[model samples]
Target chain A: MKNNIISSIRLTIVMLILFSGAYTLIVWASSQLTTSHGNGDVIYFKGKKFYSNLGQKFTNDRYFNSRPSAVEYNAASSAGSNKGPSNPAYLASVQARIDTFIAHNPKIKKSEIPSDLVTASGSGLDPHISVTSALIQINRISKVRGISENALTTLISKQTEKPMAGLFGPERIHVLKLNIELDKMQ
Target chain B: MNTEIIGVILSFLVVVILAKPMGRYMGKIFSDEKTNLDFLFDPLDKLIYKLGNIDFKKEMNWKQHIVVMLTINLVWFVLAMLVLTNMGNLALNPDGNPSMSLDLALNTAISFIANTNLQHYSGETGISYLGQLVLMLFQFISAGCGIAMAVIVVNAMKEKVAHTLGNFYYLFVRSCTRILLPFSILVAILLVLNGSPMTFEGKDTITTLQDESVQVSRGPAAAFIAIKHLGTNGGGFFGANSSHPLENPNYFTNTLEIITQMLIPLAFIFAIGYMLKRKNLAWMIFGVMTVGFLLLALPTIWNEMNGNPLIEKMGINQHGNMEGKEVRFGAAASAYWSIATTVISTGSVNAMHDSFMPLSGLFQMLGMMVNAFYGGCGVGFLNFYIYIILTVFISGLMVGRTPEFLGKKIEAKEMQIAMGVTLLHPLLILTGTAFASYAYTQNPIELSAWLNNPSFHGFSEMLYEFTSSSANNGSGFEGLGDNTPFWNIASGIVMLLARFIPIIGPVAIAGSLASKKYIPESAGTLKTDTITFGLMIFIVIVIVAALSFFPALSLGPIAEYLSM
Candidate 1:
């Protein structure tokens, strides 16, 4: 038993190095071949870097608003507003968001507002919103940026990502990338 | 079909196609048979054994195996504590995240070591890169430990019983090298190539297109995430877990993660058939588990797809329960993930359970409450075996015959252990929640922040924590503000007992069964592998889980649902 205990400790140490050290090193080496070079995909817009996959706050009138973030789009810590559906406070907050959305985009009706527009994502930094979510904000952004609605619509269509193999998952657009193109059009 | 429904079906079909070969391969590893990739693993394994000074040929009785497993797990616990608490000074602190507090460290260590991975602290700002690696180590070995113990139980079930089961070290090493490591590498490479980060760098400060500066946290996450799923250790590298875009980059990775997490638990079912040469029994168990799984999963998918009625009443075209869900996966896929992760004990969340529709939360909780549906890797089968034993005994009483399983008589001692193991699950979950409720009621002001949602939903948060802990299933409602000393220490104790007791109970039963004189099956003996017996096991599981947890369920999610 004593010998076994010693061996057990030794094995634990050896296995840790193999899994956590050597194994991670191999994966790291392989990451060097990827486009992001293992640091995560970065999109440099006007000399300012942004993680292409991570969400950013875009609440300015000139940019299409990203979804509401519980952490205010804090990339360092990801989380959700873990509010239950029946919680009165939570429901009221969603109502307030609905009111706020209607206030911002006066032409849009409350029924036209997709729930994703007002909801906080499970990851506070969700990069994409449904394609419908992107399109609804066009009226507000077009008025603010002085760009024609047709131009903004064309840009959103170009930035939209189809579901995998055109059948699985959801049709969505990267909010950061779409807004980046929106800014470049100016 | 809706794309959401199609995605859900595709994920399950992929797992079905993959389980057979993986199960066969795992069978070879466990039975000490040679395989095609063994040339690569054999030398690597030999070096491990030599360096660790392990006697690869030495066999151990069941008690020895338990003791050895615990001893090594202790080493891991200590290592985890040291690193987590001191990570502020550790070398890999590129983000300079401070070390964990003592209680949080204790909870984190126990959570990972037990393979429960109930995170009391968020991953990004909570621990350093070194701490992530240490927890990742536990992710690999703890799962290897579970698979090894399960193999021990399987060995004890052999018809021609041997005095000694295989060496714990040999089984442990082989489980890692032959089973976990190669598979993890495959997943890690896929994740890395598809844009999940895999670097030892600090967080990057990124200025948004809106000109807001936010620090984007990245690390050796792809490797961490790969084993996190493959080992069924669902401790995510980020607070939002797989919901984080980097942790699960896209729909393809989402499908891959769910499939990877569900694969091994199902594969182990097939492995049992291959090892025991009881393909009928394996199929029976598979049938029972799949039925239980779909019963939970299908409703959850339906619930999420129906959209939250409360939100719908707010004069909006609700896109299901998107409050705590991702757009890329949509409602059906996210709902599918919640049940799959819980049922398999992976606990990795692609969608936050707290924000799920009330009934959906109930289904998720029920999945954990009946943790044996497919369960975590090896331990899932162990939990299922307890139900099988109880079913055999109960049915024997009905037929007025001796309860014999696989030619071994199920005596009072084995029955006692089985009953005890079955009772422990509910006792731990209920008592822990009851205590927390008492404490909260006593000092509502002091513990006001313990719950994120009020009234019935708050009660569900507390109930879900203990349930997740006791089941060793780790996924939580997350709305529970659970980082307090009360939560950390309470759930820590629950996770420790929950993990070892179930394992010890089954191994002990299997060991005892192996030593008894074999009684040949006769017409009077019950056939455990038949569909009728599978029905009996399912009935027993439902009755046991329902009886124990129904009241708690009513108070928590069910009440919340009705109120809504």
Candidate 2:
């Protein structure tokens, strides 16, 4: 039993080392991920802090709106409240987001807001907003960049991933892609 | 689009078409129950025992046999690990696929040794030619080892004392030589005939249209691929995976691969039941497993069959949603491959699963939930024995009788072993997936930020993959660039542990039972016979799987469902 303990202990240590080593090697091999698409100036933001710089940095014309994100009272938190459309909290949150979105994009109609625009992602702090949301303000962004909303939306369509291998899920637009297209338009 | 569709069909056929003959041949080799093949190999067994001066015929009880097994199998494991670690130097010639890193080597070494072939690297570019033969060869051996252990345990449970607990050296040797080697040779040749390449050549260098010096991947792919499938250990030699024309090729080879993969495992079931003189039990086991496999798998095919909704709405119909799928075989073929390999612990992917629709993707994850239900080669059937024992135990408790499986009593100790075997890997998977999914939430990949809201869902799927991989069921539908160490090592270790630790439980129980006196198969023995026992066994398997993985499933697949 003592020998068994010793052998297993030695084995455990060896395994741990192997685990870390392999992981490190995998990490190293996957360094290609690090060298990909360069980072842009959309700083990670939280709660009301994000509202202060709304149009100052994220201009309606220059920056296409990504998904609306509230830090949800800023606790370093990130998860969808998991509330459904029927849930009051869900309704309240969606209403609040819609109000903010409408106020920000004055040129857009309240009816034009895509549901994904205001709805919190499963991860509430989703940095990306839906393409429809971006589309809601595409014309404004077009005015700033001197590109038509059609061209921008076309680019967004190209940038978007076809729903996870062609079928088995719903299609939605990506926020990061639209904003990047906005940057390229500039 | 055509490329993706054919690739899917080609791979799907590879699973179903190849599973039978190889399975039938393996069934005859492993069984103590007679076939002409066993008779021919009988002298070979005697030869090894005589030459080694060890009396294999010496009457030994179960405990002694298990101890011998522990030594032999464990020694093999260690030696295989050492060889894998040192394979870089051992290669006859260096191929484009370099030697695996230490973490990869260790994980891979143990994975093949345990007969759970979860790969972190692509066959063509990531692993060397030597690694394939040395590391991959071990999988075939370990699979045989699994059979040998089962044979020993089954014999130990027999009523009267036998002169032999099937000769380990003979069983292992004959298993590889008779069943695995011949089948692999025939299949490899057939694969080459079907256009799957089989050579020991290095990579072919090609000057691209742009005049770039790109080194195209080449190796003794078909040779190892033949064994890889026959052994039911599905690690692709290249990035194109089984979808690679050289590995799967046309529909003929595709069917051959599917048949071979299923044949080895299915035939073993026949072999085990026949050897135990319980052919009925064998069919029952197969029937129960097949029913569950179809239930989960059928939907996977149906759900993906019609094409992507987004594609329809957007009017992009040049091809069916062949996003991650191979066009050569199309939706039907890839969908079947997705279901079969996941259910069987074969992880070769023909389609990029990261792009599979939500439920189809979820079904793929669910296949791993019942992974032990129809796990890989040696591990899969032995796991069924534990499940069988457990079903008997639960039924006996309810029916007011001692739990006796095949007339051997299963008490508290056996229950402990069964529960451990059932639960240990799920814990690894659940916790690992939970941890990884949470990590994914923290770190999302920005694919031009095209990875919108569903990226987290992809992360959830990745968690499922790592869980599936580490747990020794190597099916991937969600696109995870697992060629990285984070995935490889984590998955590799999980694969190794999930594959081997469960065997320890079965072996220990077998040894313990071998020491006991066998009570006769009386009435009210809670018959492991009949469809009723099969149902009970199925229920126990389902319940344990549901309870262990359901919460995590709710977190990953369910979450993906709601998001989608």
Candidate 3:
């Protein structure tokens, strides 16, 4: 038993050094070759920095809004609302988001507000919104910014990321990138 | 078909196509047959064996295997505790995360070591990069340990009778070096190139396009996530797990994560066939697991894709239940992932299970409750072996003949151990939930903190926590405030017992069987590889899981479903 314990301890140490040390170091070294340099994909636009993959809150009406976040797009601590589908309080919050979306875009009907606009994503920091989610917010952004609705729509189409292989999953727009492009529009 | 459905089908297809070759590769590794990759891994494994003072060729009996497994696990637990509790003082404190409380540390350590990765705390804010690295280490070794123990059982199951099984250290080390490490490095590189972070740089305080400054938590997440899925140790580098955008960037990485997580559990099923030279037997087992998986998976996909009815009544026209799910992966893929992870005991989530339709939650819980349909790495087969034993014994009694498996007579001792192992799952889960429910009722006002949702759904939350822990599946309802002393300690104990007992029971049974005189098959003998026997095993699994968990299911997800 004593001999096994000693071997066990020795094995654990050796494994720790191999996996926790050598394995991770290999990954870290390989990551240095990527464009992000392992710090995450950062975009520099107009002297401001943003993580391209992480969602950010856009309270201003001039920019296309992101999905409702449980933590208000807090990247430091991500979470979902974790509310059950039938919870009254959660339903009420979704209703509240719908009402707020309708109020912001008076021209848009309540039925037109996509559910993604109201629901909080699992990560809270979801960077992309559904293509429809982005489309519904266009009226508000266009009305606020005085950019022609056509121009704004064109800009969104430009920022749209096609579904993987153009055949699987949803076609979505990266909200951060869309908003950045919106900023660039004359 | 819609792209969402296509995505789901694509993920499964990829897994099916890849699992066979990977299984054969694993077969060669465990049998010490030369593979092309051996050139790379042999030297590393030799160094590990040499440094550990292990005799790679020295065989051990089942008791010795268990002892060494437990001893090494003990060492890991202690090391994990030290690193987790003192995270603030750890070398890679880029985020300046505080050290864990003793109870939380205890739970975290056991959760990872048991291959149950059930997190009572969120990843980004709870532990440091050093801490994540240590936990990642446990992820690889714990899974390696599981595969090795399973291989020992495979060794015992061989046609020839043997006193000593293959050496545990050799199998364990080879599993890590040959199987897990190579795949992890490959997947980690894929993740890094595809936008998941792999760095020691802490939180990058980036200014958003809107001018709000927020701390974006980054780490060596690509490395962590690679092994996280590859090992079926679904503990995330971030609290949001694969659901986080950076942790699982886009649809490509999401698909990769799903594929990698399901890969080993599926491959292990095939490897058993290769090792035992019972390809038919493996195929039969695969059929049963696939049928069981589809029964749970199809409904979850339908539930999520149908969208929540209550929300529809509120004037929303969403394609599916998007609540607490990502837009890129959509409902079908997320629902597929939830069931896949649960059935395999991966327990990683691409979507928040708490926000799933109540019936989907039930299926997810059922996946773990059954706990044998393509379960975690090596242990999945071990769980299924218990079911196989029960089936053999019960069917034997019906036929008025002694039960036999692989020509070894099934005796009372093995049956007792199998029954004990089978019952321990429900016993641990129910007793733990019942105790928590009782405590919650006693001080409803004070203990209200335990649940985020109200009434029946809240009951489901507590029930899910214990179920996930007891199953060693590790995915939780998340709404449960489980970091409290009551949860941390209760579920920690559950995880420990649930993990070791099931493993020990199967190994012991295999050991006893290996030592017995071989009984050649006869006209009256029941063939485990036959369709009839497969059906019997499936029925036994359903009956056991259903009978044990039906009452608990009714109280939690079923009640929630009826009310909705």
| Model 3 chain B poorest ten-residue lDDT run | B201-210
Q: TM-score of chain B, per candidate? A: 0.99, 0.86, 0.99
**What's the lDDT of the predicted structure labeled candidate 3?**
0.91
Which docking category, incorrect, acceptable, medium or high, applies to candidate 3?
Answer: high
For candidate 3, write residues B1-564 as lDDT tens digits. 788889889999999999999999999988779999877888888888889998889889999999989999999999999999998986889778999999999999999999999999988889988999999999999999999999999899988788899999999999999999999999999999989998888777877777888988888899999998988889988999999988898889988999999899899989999988999999999999999999999999999999999999998777789889998789999999999999988899989999999999999999999999999989999999999999999999988988999999998899899989998999999999999999999999999889999989999999999999988989989999988998999999999999999999999999999999988888988888988999999999989988999999999899988988
Order of candidate numbers by DockQ, starting with the best: 3, 1, 2
The residue-level lDDT of candidate 2 at A19 comes to: 23
Which 10 residues in a row give candidate 2 chain B its minimum summed lDDT?
B446-455
| lDDT score of residue A14 within candidate 2 | 34
Predicted candidate 2 versus true structure: per-residue lDDT over B126-174, tens digit per residue: 5666566565556566666666666666665556534446655556556
Candidate 1 Cα deviation (angstroms), residue B323: 0.7
Query: Backbone collision count in every prediction?
Result: 0, 62, 0
* Model 2, residue B435: C-alpha shift (Å): 2.8
How does model 1 score on DockQ?
0.86
